[model samples]
Target: MTPDEISTYEETLGVLGDIDHRVVERVLREAGWSPCGAGDWAVALRAPDGRAAARISPFDLVAPYTVALYREAAHTRQVPRLFAHRRLVGGGDLQIMEWLEPVDADEAAGFHRALAAREPEVAELADVVRRVHERGRRDQPWFAPKLDDNPDNIMRNADGRLVAADLFGADGPRLYAAVVDDPHLVVTTIPEPERRFMTDIPLTNTGPWPPEVRAAMHESLTTADTTHQA
Candidate 1:
């Protein structure tokens, strides 16, 4: 990314507009963490000593939906336990989540490839993915899991186990707007090369993506074009 764009991303990452500083401090103190890094919409904080950390984001609609959708994932330890903290009064819904240690792309790909062998480890991870999708709601705006999520979002921690990260994606007009607004800044700023292994990722085992996901993608881009025209 250009220096200007990086600056913009840093500025916008986890930017709390008009949010009270007290809330940020509370989350940091209570979570026993300090700011370490960030993503498009969330701030990642590291623990004082260990590899553990907390990923905190301002109250957002996606947080609640993610927590609900990953019920089985949380149960099966496919994902870090999502904590809904109302401790910040009037600060919307602050999400303080456990941050799992991330294994490099090659390591994650190794495990994913093992799935082709029907390996138990990969099977368990696949099962967690299955559960996540099973709980997904088609009627909901964010039903297109294939488009929103990817293998790069999966992490191999210290234990060599697979964990899902960046689990919240609400597909709708808002998501469309974000992509339309800036394809690089919001969508592809970071290179996700490991995604090639996931051509057959979706459990559906279909050759291509679901019809609905393709339709949603096309609609989002088209809507953006139409909006620009007007």
Candidate 2:
């Protein structure tokens, strides 16, 4: 990425570190990536050219997890094609990806209907999801079972192919603890059901956010939340 683009990322470095979150948002807007949506973890943006979308995060692991998914996962046809990834200095990542078109309420509902009917396209989606989940359990521990079982997380490519968006999630406390050895690290609250479930499970199956393997995603989600607010 260009220096200007890098400026947008590096400045808004998220949790577990000190950085200016305001600058990250300002620069991203200035760079012409219009904000599309915001979640607990990151902000979604559409590129100026209209051909690509971006997952902007102040967390360090977003890019690595995404890149790993695209590269290591056996099935990815249903997922958006990653274009580029920029790892920031303060544990954040910027990902450029294929811009999937919006699915209107009707379209989304129709997709669900088709999914229920086990139409060819939706059948393919199921297969893809199963394979990805299987791989996530066997190979990628950083991955959590986050693919929502609904149409909201579904989109379509330019060619009208079904695309699964937001394929993974980050475990904030686990990730932060993994990266930083802060004995005083506050146990904010009990892990949410999904996280607790993962923690409770033993050797296999559950998505264990192993510190050694996922330490690269050390940035705090609290920081991302602040950045998003900024």
Tens-place lDDT per residue, model 1, 21-99, is: 2455464667566776654434566655544455444423345455554455566565655543331223223444445
Instruction: Tell me the spans in candidate 1 whose CA falls farther than 4 Å from its real position.
Output: 1-22, 25-32, 49-51, 68-71, 74-77, 81-93, 97-99, 111-119, 147-152, 158-160, 172-230
Candidate 2 is scored at a TM of: 0.51
Number of the top-ranking candidate, with TM-score as the measure? 2
The regions of model 2 sitting more than 4 angstroms off are 1-27, 60-63, 71-77, 104-142, 171-230
* Lowest summed lDDT window (length 10), candidate 1: 190-199
Give per-residue CA lDDT, model 2, range 1-230, as digits (tens): 34565444334443324322334456667889798866555667887877777766654333465566554432637667766666543455567677787687677767666654668865765555556565655554444655444566678888787666665555445644643453123222212222221221122223445665443332443343344446
TM agreement with the true structure for every prediction: 0.49, 0.51
| Superposition error at 4 for model 1 (Å) | 46
Alpha carbon lDDT of each predicted model:
0.47, 0.54
The CA lDDT at 168 in model 2 is 55
